[model samples]
Structure formats: structure tokens, C-alpha cells
Target: MVVSTRAGAERSQNITVVRQAPPMSRTVSAAGLGAVGGMVTEYLFDPELGRSRRARLRDKGVRLTHGVRNGTRTVVRDVRNRGQGVLGAARYRTTGREADDEVLHERVRAELGRHVRHPREVDVRVESGHVTLTGDVLDRESRRAHRAVARIPGVAGVDASWTTHHDARRAPRSREDGGPMEALQDLFRQRWSPAGRSLTGLAAAVVWSLSGRLPRPLGYLVRAGCAVLAARAATNLPLRRLTGIGAGRDAIDVGDSISVAAPAEEVWPVLSDYGLFARWMPDVLDVRRSDDGGRSQWRVSGPAGVPIRFEAVETAREEGRRIAWKTTEGQLVAHSGELSVTPEDAGRSRIQVRLTYNPAFGAVGHAVAKIFGADPGRKFAKDLMRLKSLIETRRAPVGAGAGPRE
Candidate 1:
């Protein structure tokens, strides 16, 4: 007779088989035992939860042939189609010593683009992951370029010694960042311009008159104010190109947009993961979140590995849509940025990031920052590309075990 028995929702169930026949008889008469088992065995099965195939086996049970169990290992395997063996081994090989020439070339090109003003002018040749950079480039660019190439994941070595900086290849002198004096001169020259020269003259006359009429202390303040305003106005005017200064502007603005073949939900988690930002963002040495997790501080390496530190807070956010941040405190550089995610048809998303920052020392600091690939626009674009590659490819995290596949 069947005793009390019940099954869980799991496709498989715990079962107990009680032995009554003699052990000798059971061993010697397999066919006879099978005949008796067919008439005595009972199963308790539940169909509501058929997702799992594992079950526990217990003792202390009688059998009745009235019920059925529908669990099977093959069914679960078919549903998920999981793979076995070295997980991510192929990906690891592709990113390391076993990387092919094409992979190495791509990495080299991307790196060169970030540091060199004219990447197309450089000749990049990669064989067995050894890189040879040959082209006419600036002296400073050549040094920076070689160092950057050496740091790529698969580059065995860099050969750029033959690279020369010719006068012809040298950017025009006008493209150089004139010092503070030159910037002041550019603003003074604008006093004769047709558009705003009248207003400029009027403002100067007002400042001069006010300075004489005001008391000594207030007069000094008026003159100082006039000087500061005049300097700012000059820096804003279109002046000769300053070497290393982008767009002749004191502040840097960078923007980029990319299409990712993943849903917004899938991309948001990776974007908000501040700890891993350093992994995809170049030059970031370390990043930490505050105790409340609302603020983040970043330690970054600048040219020649000089340390630059900054703290930022998330200013605004929308779930699965966008995030905006600004530096609350920093050394050498101050920055603000935003990232937006938009859903398109299918399971694709368009992701965009924009960043703007000004150096603490103005034009000089801006020029020095370019030496380290610290340009906000250039950094933004490269970081976005890295992010795109990581998310779309779904590669395993850097140090995950090969035994388990996620």
C-alpha cells in the first residue's frame, strides 16, 4: 500500500524505497525483482514547478503504482543549453599574448589616436604583437606616442626611435597657446573691431571715470575689476591657435555618441559601477565611493604618471536613462559631465556622454594636460568606445574563474 507522500513544486522529488525482499533473492533474481518492483513502486510528483531536475532520495516509504514522476535531467539541459569546459579562455587568449596581428593593430591605432594629433600621418605596423610606429610627428608627440603604444594590452614592444619631428610636420606657431601676455594683447587688439569696439571703448571710459571719482580704496577696486574683465574678454575672442590648446578656448568640451546593441536596463548597471570606471577609462588609477555611496573620488595619473585627484557627486539621475555629475573638489582640473541613454527599436540603445572642464591654472594647465591624454573630449570618446566594446561583447570580467560561466 502507498503510505503518506507529497511532492514539492520542483520537477524532481525526494523518494524513499523500502526493501522487504531478501537481499540474496534480490541479488540473484534481478528479473524477478523487477517484476515485483513494477507492482509495488509509487511516485509523488508535482507539475506546477517543472523548472529544476534535482531531487533528494530518502528511505522509510512503501510503494503504490498509482502516481507518476515527470522530472528528467535532459529537459532541464535542453532549456538552458549550457556549455562546459574552459569558459572565456578564447577571449583571454584574444586579449593577451595569443592575440593576432589585427587585434594588436586595432589597439595600437586606438591608442595612437588618443595621444597623437595626426594619427593618420603615423605608420603603425604590428607583427606578432610587436608594434613599429614610423612617421613624421612632433618630438613631444613621438615620446608620448611610444609610451602609449607600449602600454596597450597585447603590444610586445614599441619601435618608434626612427620617428622624427620635422619643421614641416611641426604645427604652425600660431597654433601654439600664447602666454597670458599674448592673450591680453589679442583682447586689446579687439578694441578696434567693427562689431563691439564702441561698447568696448564705452566700458573702458566708464571704468576710467569711475576710478577717479571713487575713493582711493574703491578706485583701486574699480581699476582691478576693469583689468580682470578685459583679460576675460580677450581670452574669449578668437585668437591665434595656441599649441596644445584645443580650439583656442580656456575650457575644454568633449562629446561622443555610440549605439549599443543592448537594452537600457542592461547598460545602466555598468555605467553606474564607479569602481570599474577605471577599467574602461584610461589614466584612471583608482576610484572609491563614499560611505553613503552618493559621492566618488578618483585618483588619476597624468603625464609621466603624475597623480591628479578629484571628487565628484552625482548631480542628477534618471533610472535607465541618464546621469549627470560635477566635480565638487579637485586638484589641477575641474570637470562636469553627463551621460544619457535612449532606447531604440529592438533591443538596442544609443548612449552619449559629454564632458567639459577647465584647468586650475588656465591656459598653461590646459596645454600641460594635453601631454597626458587628459583632454576631456578625447578621454570622453575613448572611454565611450571602451564601454561600448565591453557591453556589446559581454566578455567575462577580468579575473572571473574559468570553471563557472555566468
Candidate 2:
């Protein structure tokens, strides 16, 4: 009986332990949620930039709501139009009615434009539902063009006549001759275009829906794809630009300008000389130019005395005016920079520097660097000001050293 009583006591203890587990888990989850809430509150209600941040958030929310509403309306309208087209096609088939000669000609012409690479070179004419294609055409495109025109809703027959060239270069028509859809595709490939955003947004929605129905690892991949599509749709930026793959005029990550008391000619010498950079440029410990004068290796003092090294090749130089350089291949960081000197009144010169960089971890690395006061933009601004002072005084600025300037 004592043993039985002991077992009952143990059973009660087990029940108590099981009952305690949920409350502990709930407490932890609540604490986590509270921490997240506090962080979000601090981020949106900072002392200096809170108002602007909140306003920006509100504006973005409004824009997103509007975008969703407009996209829904557009989708509904397209569905309605497609349904009408289907119904019309059914009616025509049932009645055995044919389109008018003018309508047929227009349809054939449109089909030719869609199928032919050099639509301008292919002169299309249609009479009584018969399409006649004439003029210079590429042999590769001729069969497809004939087939496309023949398959038109109102086309009765197609007659091909003509000159066909095997090589596009030898063809009479210029390579730039592309149809309407091709032109639209070119525009859609650009960074931000209306058509691109619309198509990408639609694709994102489709992919997002499919992602939920997919299984396991494939589903995870589809989810990632959906995220990429959604980001592209919202930002209207190409994958390369969004990820900071290559440097271009549009990829300028940091830029600043300073006015110097010295003439452009005088400032040009100091700026162009890579050896002089370490003296004025903040955190730049050493710079060594190649014998050919086209490439230079740079060592900049990073956080905790760590050295950041990279090699750059001068891509272009216009004496006393502009200079440009880009990092060599296979570097941890991809970067390019351009400096231009413009003369102003009273022997003053405006020096502008533009730098583009794709560092490790992309934007996250950039943000972390900024938080650590290692942002190149901030350094560039400070360095330019120091350069201005150095040029004007003909001496090194106070506090200029091998380490970063305060």
C-alpha cells in the first residue's frame, strides 16, 4: 500500500511537470514577441529621424494599397476581355462566318509583325483572306513567317515570293529592325519600366501561389524564387543591379563633391597621383602604383587595425579633367571610382568623386559597415575635405595619419 501511494505521488509530480511546460514556453514566446515589438518601436520612433521615418512608412503603405487595388482591377479586366474573345470565337465558329477582307489583311499583317524578325523588310498584302509575303527575308524566318500568317484566324492562303539570305549580316534590312513585341521586351529588360513591373508583379503572384502547393526542398526553392520575383516587381530593378553585381553609371553607390581654393590644373596633379592619396585620404595607409602606371595596389586601415587591400586599374584618364578606375577581377569586393575636376571662378575648382562598390554580403555588409563608421561614402567626404585643406595650405591637414581620421 505504501508503494502504491508512492507511485500515485510520482504520477501527480509528472502531471505537474507536464502542466508547467506550456506556461514556460508561453512565457518565452511572449518575451520574444515583446523584444521584437520594442525594437520595432525604437526603430520607428528614434529621437532624430522618427517623424520622417513614420511618414515614409505611411506613404509606402498607401502606395502598396493602391498598387494592390489597381493590379486586381487590371487582372479582372484582362480576364473579362479574354472571356469575351472566347465567346466571340465560339459564335464565329458556330455561324461559319468569316471576317471582312480588310480585317483579314490587318490580321495577317499583325501576324507577320509578330513572327518576322525584320518585319519592315517583309511587305505583307492580303486580299480576299489570302496573304502574299514579298521582299527581302531571311531564310530562317521565311518558313516561320509563312506558317504564322497562314494560321491567322481569317487567312485563307499564303503566297511566299522572294529573296532570302542565309546570313543576317548580308541581309538588306538592318539588324535593328524588330517587331513591336521585341521592342516591348527590350524595354521590359530595363531597370524600371511600367510593363516590366506589371509582368513581374503578375509572375510573382503566380509563383507565390505555386510555392504553397509544392513539396519540401522544392517548395523552399520556389519560396525563394517568389521572394526574388516580389522584390523585382516592387523595386523594378534587374537582378544584377539589385544584388550589386557590376558597376555602371546607374550603380553609383556613393558620391560627393567639394570646392577647393586651388585651380583645376593644380588640383589635378595631386588627385591624379596615386602615391599622394595616402597622405590626404583618410585611413589609406599605402598605395603602390604599377610600373606601367595603369594599375595600383591600395591598403586601407580597417577596424581594429585590420588592413583592407585591393588592386585597381585605371580605365580612363583625361588630363586635368577626369580619371576613372575599377577593381581587378576576382577581388573580394568589386568597386569602381571616377573623379572629375571642373574649374570655377577665382582659381577655385569643383572636384567630384563617384564610387560604386559591391562588397561581401551585398547590402547587408554595406549597412553593417555604415554602422561601424566604415562606410566609404563617409570616408570619401572626409578625405575630400582634407584634400581641399591640404591643397589650399600646401601642408598635411592636422590629425592626418596612417589610421582613420576622427
Candidate 3:
């Protein structure tokens, strides 16, 4: 009796322990969520660029909200249009009144293109709702053309006088002739095409559902695939372009233009003097040009006072007009820049600068830099403003300091 009682007690204890296991899982999940939240907070509230990053996040949120609203409206409109088309089709079938001969001819002609391989070769004529088709057509295509014309809302009869050839090679080819893959590619490229929408929607749904059910690395991969499909559906950009691959991936371009009060000739000296770039260019600490003036080395201050160094060769030069340079091969970061000065009215000049840089990590590095307030585009705009002030006022701007320019 005692042994039986002890065994019963142990069994109850085991049951209680098993029942408690789920809470531990719940606790671990909560901790993971807390860690994620802490990391996000640290990222957005960094000491140096927190305010700007937060502002950017807020702006992006607003834009995303607007996009969602607009997308909803578009979907609703599409559904309404489809419903109207169905109703119109039904109404046309139910009506008994005979359509005019000219109207019936236009309808048959319109329907013929969808069914026939070579619509232009087939001539169409309609008299009292009777459609007459006369042309050289393939034997495989003639029956379909007759049936399609006869099915039109007001088509009474179809008279096919076409010379049917058994061999398709001898018949006239269609303007849209292509292989199956070509057709699919064309359909996928369209932003809001039915096929594209259906495929992306199905893919997104399947992957999203599987992402939660899958485990660890597999789940992560599925989530990434879902994101890529969603983005492709929204933007209609090719995978190569979206992922920053292929030929143009080496050139991430940013540009800005500013007007200066001085003449083009005066501005030319300020721009052409590579040695004095540190004075007006933000973050540039030193510039050293080769004896031939065809090559130059630059030292720039990066985020957290990290030193960035690169060598560039002068690719193009036109006196008082334009200067272009590109980084030497085998560099970690590929960089190229162009500056142009154009004469404007009232003795003014317009200076335009274009810079292209492909970082070591591609688009992801660029995005991270932008988020941390290290965007070269914004820096160049500030540099242009400082240069404009220095040239027009004949001295440094009000808050110019000895350290690297902000």
C-alpha cells in the first residue's frame, strides 16, 4: 500500500513538471522580444545621429502609411472595374435587339485580333450582322477565327473564305510571335498585370505562412524571400537592379547643383585648385596631387574620426568647363566624380557636381551610412553652400572653424 501511494505521488509530480514546461518557453520568448526592442532603441537613439535617424524613421513611417492607403484604393478600384466588365458582358448577352451593321463590323474586327494568329492578313466585312472573313490563314487558325466571330454579341453568321494552308511556316506570322518564356518574361515585367499580381500574391502568401511554421535558418530564408517578392511586386524592378548586381552596380550616383554669384571664369579657379579642396570641402582633411596633375590622393574624416584614404586619376579635363576623376583600380571603394561650371546671366555661374561611389558592401553599406548621417550627397550639398558663401562674401562663413567641416 505504501509503495503504491509513493508511485502515485511521483506520477503527480511528473505531471506537474510537464505542465510547467510551457511557461519556460513563454519566458524565453519574452526575453528574446525584450532584447530585440533594446537593440532597436540603441540603434535609433545613438549619441551622435539619433535625432536625424529618428526623424528619418518618422518620415518613412508616414510615407508607408500613405502608400498603404493609396494601394487599398487602387485594389478597390480594380475590383469594381472587374465587376463592371462582368455585368456588361452579361447585359450584352441578354439583349435581343440587333446591332447596326457598322457596329457589328467593328465588334467582329476587334474580336478577330484576339483569336487569329495573323489578324492583318484576314479582311473583315459585315452586312446585317453577318461577318465575312476572306484571307490566307493557317488551317489550325481558321476554325477558331470562325467560332470567335460567330460568338460576338451581334454576329449573325460567319463566312470563312480564307485559303487554309496546313503548313504554318507558309502563312503570315503574328507581330507578337514569341516563345513561352518570352511571353512570361513580358508578363512579369508589368507592374500591375494580372499574371504578375497573382504570382507575387501567391508567393508572398505561401512564404509568409511557412516562415512562422518553419524553424531557425529555414524560417529566416523564407522571410527574406517573402520580402523580396513583396518588393518586386511593388516596384516592378528586376532582381539584378533591386539587389544591386550586374554592370551598373559599381556606380551609385548622387548629384547636386548650385548657383554662385561669381562668373564662370572666377569659379573655375576655385574648383580646379585641387590642393585647396580641404578649405571648402566638408570632411576633407588633406589633398595631395601628383607632379603631372593627373593623379591625386585624398584623406577624409569619416564617422567617429575614422580616416578614409583613396587615390584617384583624372579621367577628363576641359579648361573652365568640366573636370572628371575616377578612383584607381583595386581599391576597397570605387569612386568617381565630375564637376562642371556653366556661365549664367548677370555675371553668375552654375556649378554642378556629380559623385558616384560603390562601397565594399554595396547598397546595404550606403543605406547604413545614410541612416547614421554620413551620406556623401548631403555632405556635398553643404560643401557647395559653404563654397558659395566663401566665394560671394570673400571670406569663410560665419561659423567656420579649424577642425573638419560638419
Candidate 4:
């Protein structure tokens, strides 16, 4: 049985409190808590909670205790931040991104393949963003690893203390710069963009290419015009179309804002992975990107696996931060656009997507007036949630501040 005394919204409950030491309590050192939470979670208390409380937390939740050793501060800092920043850290919190990353690194490493302790050679890997430093340095080679990482291009920066162990003072040499483990992480980053073929946006577009009231060839033209107007319309988005201009290539407007716990530099690698679409952006099907050469494609899929008639091609491409694509199958519609990311204030960046697609059929064969539509507005809302998830999950060195954008 449970009993509670309550006044207003504050409630003190008399319930069976399982006063057991939490699993990570031993690793949650006082210093770790302070590093991640500024000087919090150091005090001892009764009734330590478990991660099982995930369901009960609203707005936030936490489970903390302290007894870390060695890199105690690093361990405890990550434990306090065991979930998203909103998830809370009993005494103090950030987000468990650092902890989560450690778990991930250990999990998919070799096979996947990663580092192992031995007596001959020691290999160190430091993954900051875009670049991964994988090479062999001597024992406690951490300092040497940082120096190497800083010299690598395409990398924003490296966490100085990141390194691995070995038994030999003199190793032949690392096979290449980074191994398969670093490759996997970097590979995924490349595939995460929104502008590529085989993307969810392309899939949704394919689904809708045949959806709605307007008919294509003619309808495509309508959709294209609408899409152009929507792109130019707003930076924030209300996208309430004034009239129900029939579809084909109707303009679409998607607005989003995502907050991350670290600075912009840390957040750069994560954002660099994505391009410009939600898994639900209607009409196009498969979007794939390739920097090996200057070629990218957006393939359309229909009722089943069948390919539709619409596919977009990239006419111009930049390795990082920018991409411009165009399709001139103008019989039905023509699609043209560029996605640009500009760093905003507070370690954050603003993603601006400018698109101009011509929807077939108009009074004089020219782009025309607009109307207020509501459904696309709702989808944009859902997309914002997804971006928030991706950015907040980016990992960094334990104890060091998360350079994520808040």
C-alpha cells in the first residue's frame, strides 16, 4: 500500500521506496557530476532510483549516485546524462550523449572491428566530426593521437584524451589512417543526407506523385508552382495556403528548429550527415548522393516497387554544406533547388532550402497565385521532432563539454 501527503502540485508520498544502490551509482563520481552538471549531484541521499523510471518522468527524470574511480569524473558525468538532456540526472544533468557514445563505440567496434588491449601495438581512434583518426601511437599515446587528429582535414576537432592500449613500444605502423570501425561511422554520416536518392523524402514524393486531386503531366505543373511559392514564402512557416490550387507540383514549405546541448562545432558533424527531407516528405521516392563523382539522383517509386516517370538529377554539387539539383522533364514539371546551412547564434545553424519547381497547367503557362493549405504544415511539425532526436544524440568525449548547439 502507498500513501501520500499533497498540497497544490507538490506531493510527498509514503510508498515502498526500493532504497537499493543504482547500477551506475558506483561509477557516478562527484567530479563527473560536477563536470557535466556544474556542481550538482555530489550530495549523498537515500532512495536511489533506477533507469526503470523512464515511464514516470514527464518533462524530465533522473537517477544518480557517486563512487567513481580513475576517470571517475568522466564516468559519472556520462551517467548523470544517461538520456536526453530533458531526461534529467537526479542531481544534475546534460544529455547522456557522451555515455551513449561510449556504449555505441564498444558495441559496433570490430567485426565491425575496433581496438583491443595487447602487449605489442596500441591503436587510437578519435572521432570528432567528418574525420576519424585511426592510427597507432605508443602507450598512453592519447596526447600523440590528439596531435595527429588536429592535422587531419575535414575534421572539425578531436577530443585530446581519446586513445586505446597496446603492449609493444614499437609497432610496424597502422595499416592506413582509420580502420573499418571509423569507416562505418563516417559511412553512415554520408548516407544520412536529405538530398540523396533512396531517401524517405523521395519515397513520400513518389507516393504522393499519384495522390491528391490534380492529375500529373497537368497536375505536376500545379505542384511545381505551389512548391516554388511555398519555398519563397516563409523562414518560420505558417504555410496556410490562401486557396486550394489543384496539385501537380504544388509548392511545399517545411520549417524546423532543433536544440542540442553542445556548441555548433560539435553539432556540425551530425548536421553534416543529413540533407533536406523527412522520411515523410511526399512525392519523390528514392534519393541517393555520391561525391565520388558529380552525380546524384532522385528515383521515384510507384504502387509497388515499380519506378515512376519522375527522377531528379543534381546539376551542381559541393562536397560539404551545399547541393544544387535540377530536373528538366518539364513536360509535366521542372524541379530546381539548393540546400544551404548557415551557422546561427548559440552554437546552432539555420538550414535554408530554396526550391523552385514548375507545376504544369496555368492560365497562361506561368507560375501563379497561392492558397492556404494545412496538411503539409502538420507534417512539418513531425519532421522537426526527428531533427531534434538526431542532433541531440551526437556523441563527444566524456567530461569535456558537449559542443552541441543548445
Candidate 5:
């Protein structure tokens, strides 16, 4: 959610927070007793009750520069509010550890993004200048907003020195207070936690491996067998060269496509972001591109109990238009691929992936893909389908680049 403030129009929602809403803040004049009293009263009447104390600082004019929920404590750690101008010695929240400082910034960014209502315009950036804000807000009510953002956990000071023009919209989005302070409420609403489902799948695998239930053999046996096979495969020089399981190998013949209810090119953007590999590739660690060139790398979590290591080498083009590579070196040696984006009608993209891996164990290797196949492979397939769902529906990607590898 975002928080926005236009020049003059009134009708905004609550405070809009965005990106990583951490906490909210405000400044107060130590000398103003009435202002402080008003703030105290406001806190006593808040809805969440958990964050009501935040209102107490509105003492001076008793402002609410921030709308974050960082416990219920008024702090004295800001430089701009220090009265004197050194660092610290002023006012702010103490999250206990300094390492968690980024939380404050993300939180503030979230707050502003999710709550920005019909404001003339809103822009944020960090520069050598006094941190400028050059948009028009609804009323003077938003003046504190600029101050609020400026007094963020680590912010130095404000340069609201920019001029504020006049103009405001009537009804704004609901998440954002009917005002300009709401533009960050749902910035990352698409996030989905796969823990429950992943755990269930793991459990099923366990069950199948232990007691013979369905049409398959015991799960443990398969796993143990796979482990043994993987161990043997890793030690095998030929196998080592095939999958590129350990050594930093390049992905070969990388041809992937999205078969959605739409057409090709729809999944372009998501596919373009090489870093997005983390989100789609299962059991994969980091998918990176060498700064030296377009060559890509995959750090894969080695099969069972093994540490993470380079699993494949890859190369892509047209921002993923044509992705192909070879296993320069892990699990499968001399791997190659040709991923094509064949567009399907009805807004679906038919992504055709032709991957060929040189398996040292040949048939034995095929067995591994068979066991873990249905699910993870299906997951890989499902991600493409997900790419379809998200692409066709024009929805945002699930998480930040990727979720934990399955």
C-alpha cells in the first residue's frame, strides 16, 4: 500500500504503506503540552490498539509523520529532531539491532506505496540533495507526511523545500486512507507461502518410501536407492561430466517456452529477468549471469545431504527469447537445450522446452528423473503453467524473484 497526498482535494483513505512496510513515526515539540495531550488522547482511541501509542507523539501539533507499527515506544534517536544537529541524540525507534535497519526503510517504502491516494504526483529517491519531494498534496495535512518520511529510521532530514502545487481528487483507493498517504497496501499481496504444500508433498514421499501404499514401492527405498545411485553417479567421471552437478557448468541448449491461455511473448518479461530463476527452478540455489558476458550459472542444491554447488551452465538471449546452454561441467554432463515460446491461442502461450542431457548412467539416470519426475518436473511444468496463469491474467509474480527451492 502507498500513502499519497494531493494539493487540495480531501477524500483519501488511511495511510498507504508499500513494498516493505516496517514502521511509522512522527515528531513533537517538547514544549507543547496541549499538542502532547491531544496525541495521548488519539492513541487511546485507535482501532488496532496495538499501535495506538504512536499517536502520543502528536503532542506538538502532534504529527504522525510515520504510520509504521514498531511496537509501542516513543524513541529519541533522530538527528534532524535533535534540536542540535549532530547524529543520533534525536528521536526514532530502536528495533534492538542495527542490522535490522533495512527493515525500517522497506517498511517506510511499503507504507508510502500502499497508501498513496489521488495525489498530483509522488516521487522518492536518495541523493546528495536534502532528499527532495516535489509533488502537490491535498492539504497542509500532508506536510507532516513529507516530514514523516524524512524522519524515517535512518533518514537525516527533509528538503520539503520543493514547492507544493494545489489540486486533489475526491475518492481514492480504499486501502490508502481516502487521502494521499495510501499507496503501498498491496504492493506484494501476491506472495504465497508454499511451506504447507511442500511439507505435505515431502510427507507423501516419506509415506510412499516407508510403507508400500499406492501402486508404487516404499518411498525410503526409492530415496535410498536414488541416493546411492546419485552417489555412484557423482563419483562416475562420465556422469560427472554429464549433469554438471558440482562444477560450475554452463547450461546448454536452453530452450524453454510458456504455453499459456494467451500467445507467445506474453511471458517475456518474467522470463527476461534471469534472476527470476530462483522462483521457478526447483532445488536450485542462485541463477546468475556473469558480469563479463551473457553467460549464466546455476548453483544447485546437490542431491540429498550434499552441500550446494554449481549444477549447470547456461546462456539466454532476447531477454530469454531464445535460451540455450551446455553443461560445461554436474549431475548431467554435456547438457543442452532449445527453449521456444510457441504462442497458443486463447491467450495461452505454448512453451516448448527441448532439453537433452548426456547421462552417463543412461537408463539408471532416466530412473532418477522418473522418481522425482512426476512432482518436481510437474512443478517445473507447473511453473510454466503458472507463468501462463500470471501472464494471461496479467497478475504479478508470486514472490521476490523466487521462493525457496523445493
Candidate 6:
């Protein structure tokens, strides 16, 4: 039997106070205090408990304890020490909690896959809630992977220190997984429809008529200018219908345009505001953008309010000019689209959205497509009109850092 001190001397007690060595106690660390019936199992103590340290411990459920490590006594005082920056190098160490190991691993991998291009090649390990992402990633992909995992809910922290850059040959493909030439070829082929051909012919005729009135050298210059303009227009015109998938050959091609009173600089922020887009855009429930601003996953409410989800990656972007994205995970929604912001005047800009997606429910979908017309132009026009209304009136939905308009 063990006798206790003070008034409880008559009762027997079993208590073990495990003290760690001094050399290992430079920073704050938590240790198990051994269970004594109803007593706490973990005791976290450090000698210099600054404001930041105390806040970290308090936030993480740590308490103060009067103790000694290796014969050096520790002070147990109020955690009100001041004159310290909040950005101090104060790391809180701990023994991980009881979490489902399998669940943690699955979640980590899923989040990584959603953000990284080649998740199969990446290695992930999870103990309790702490995760380690170690693999060879392409340039800039490693940082994005780290940021993506860190945003997950149950993730306590991610240790990406071991992540390395792969050589060019072995590097993983980016979210935009196709070669530049292939993308360009696809673009040209998609724009080679009957209507596109008609428009190109009309443009050529107009250019020829205007150039014939100019001097010999000026006429040649005019022809060259028209050729450049035609190429640019073909790419900007977003009217491509890829066969097979969605409504099969009867897939939906959507195009819409709106003129906002504000310039692209003011309007670009609203378009990129993924978190609040659902509030303004029709049928969308939420959008989650990955780090590096190159990829995103969208969750939308579908028929009967059922949630439909898809992942997309940015293929190309030109600041204040045009941005294009294509679906990488085409399980639910196979689509590709582009948005262009053209300056109309000093203070106004025109925003155009060209999207082509497969509503893949073959038979019933084809019937529905016939009912809704060959293209989703009307629905898209309505969507863009809503955006124009919101931006022009400065009445965007509530989002982070959004306040009353000036």
C-alpha cells in the first residue's frame, strides 16, 4: 500500500510522475503522466511559458503543472508574459490522438488526388492525425500538394519536408495533362464547324474588300492583319461540341456573354471568388479551388437537389485576358470551357463564357436536349445576365473580405 501526503494520508495511492531528460526538453513537449484511476494520462509542461506558448497549449487542451526535469525546477505562474511577437517559432508537440487510421489515410489520399495530377505515384502515411506526404512532384506541384492537404478538416498537420522535385523526364504531368500542340489541334478542330466556316468566309470577304481599295503594300499589310485577327477570333469563339459522351452526338454546347460596368480588374475578383460563386451562379452549390489557383472541384445541386460533383483544372490563363479550364475527373460531368474578359472602354468590360458539357443520360437526355433546344444558349444567357446584374449594381453575395461597396 502507498500512503499519500497531507490530509489524504490514510488512503492508498498509485501515482507515477515520469520526467523526461533535460537535453530533450528545449521546446514544449507533451508526455504521458500514466493513468492513476481518474487522473489525466498526459501532462504537458515547459519552463518558459510565453503568451504564444500558453495560447497554443490552451487552445490544444494543455494545462500547467509544477514540475522539474533533470533536477531543474520549473515555475508555475500565470501565462500572461508579454512583449513577444505572435509569429514566434513556437511549435506544439504532442502524442497523436485516437483516430481511425484507415479513414485518415483514405481522406489524405482523396484530398491529394483532387489537387495533385498524379496521386497514384505519391506516397501518403497517416499516424493518428499527423500526415506525411513524401514523393517526387513536378515543380510547384509539391507546394500545392502541401497547401491542399493542410486545408483538410481532420488533418492536424502535414510534414512535407521529405517531398522532393522530380527530374523533367520523370516529372508528373500537371493538372493540364495534354501537350500544347494537342490542345491547339483540339481547339482548331472544334472550331471547324459549318457555322465557324461561314463566319471565317464572311471575315475573309470583308478583309479582301477593304484591302483591294488600299495601295499595293498597304493591301498586303491589311491582309496579314486580317489573318491574325481571324486566328484570334477562331480561338475566342467557344462553340465546340465533342461527339460521344453526355447526350452522345447531341451534346449541349453553351455560350453566353455579358457586359459589366466595372473593368476586368474589379470584375475578375468576383469571378475568381470560388467560395461565394454558388450564391450568384445558377445551380451551383459550392466550388473549392486548390492551391496555385490552377485547379478546382465544384459541387452542384442537381435534379431533386441531389449533389453532383466534378473536378476541373485550368489549362491556360492570361491575366485580365482569358482563362480556360477542362474537366480532369469526367466521371460525372465531362466538360471544357473558357472565360474571356475584353476591355470595352476605359471603365467597362465584356465577359463571355463558352462551355461545352455532356449531359450523358443518353436517351432521356437526348429528348430533354431537343426540348431545351440544340444548345444551352438561353440558360447560359440567363446565368451571365445574373452576373452582369450583380457586378454592375455592386451587389455580389457575402464572401470573405467582401463588404459594402464604395
Winning candidate number (TM-score): 2
Task: Please provide TM-scores, in order, for all candidate models, with all chains considered together.
Answer: 0.37, 0.63, 0.56, 0.28, 0.32, 0.36
Per-residue CA lDDT of model 6 for 192-223, tens digit only, reads 44344435646876987789889999999989
| TM-score, candidate number 4 | 0.28
lDDT of 3 by residue, 1-406 (tens): 9999999999988874334356878999999999999999997999998889899999999999998887777767777787797798888877833689888877877776776666777888888877788887777777877887788887778889878878756766534462111123534563455445546767897879868978889998988888878766755655544455551424356889999999999999888888767777757778899999999998877657787898989999999999999888865556788989999999999999988776544555566678776776787788889888877887767654355644
Candidate number achieving the greatest lDDT relative to the actual structure: 2
Clashing pairs in 1: 175-241, 175-242, 175-243, 176-242, 176-243, 177-242, 177-243
In angstroms, give how far residue 322 of model 3 lies from its true place. 1.2
Go through the candidates in order and give the C-alpha RMSD of each one to the true structure: 33.9, 7.3, 8.5, 30.7, 33.8, 34.9
Poorest stretch of ten by lDDT in candidate 2: 179-188
Off by over 4 Å in 3: 1-202, 211-222, 230-251, 398-406
The true-structure Cα RMSD of candidate 2 reads 7.3
What C-alpha lDDT, on a 0 to 100 scale, does residue 20 get in candidate 5?
61
Q: Between 2 and 5, whose lDDT is larger?
A: 2
Better of 4 and 5 by TM-score: 5
Native-to-model Cα distance after best TM-score fit, residue 201 in candidate 3, in Å: 7.1
Candidate 2: the clashing residue pairs are: none
Tens digits of per-residue lDDT for model 4 on 290-354? 66534445554433445555445666655446666666454334456665555667766655455
- In candidate 4, stretches whose alpha carbon ends up further than 4 angstroms from where it belongs are 1-284, 290-293, 300-309, 315-320, 330-333, 359-374, 394-406
Once fitted onto the true fold, the runs of candidate 6 whose alpha carbons sit more than 4 angstroms away are 1-250, 361-367, 370-375, 397-406
Quote the lDDT for 3 in model 1: 32
lDDT of 3 at 43: 78
Tens digits of per-residue lDDT for model 1, 229-319: 5544434433222222343222556678999989999988887777767667756667898998778888877546677788888888887
lDDT of 2: 0.77
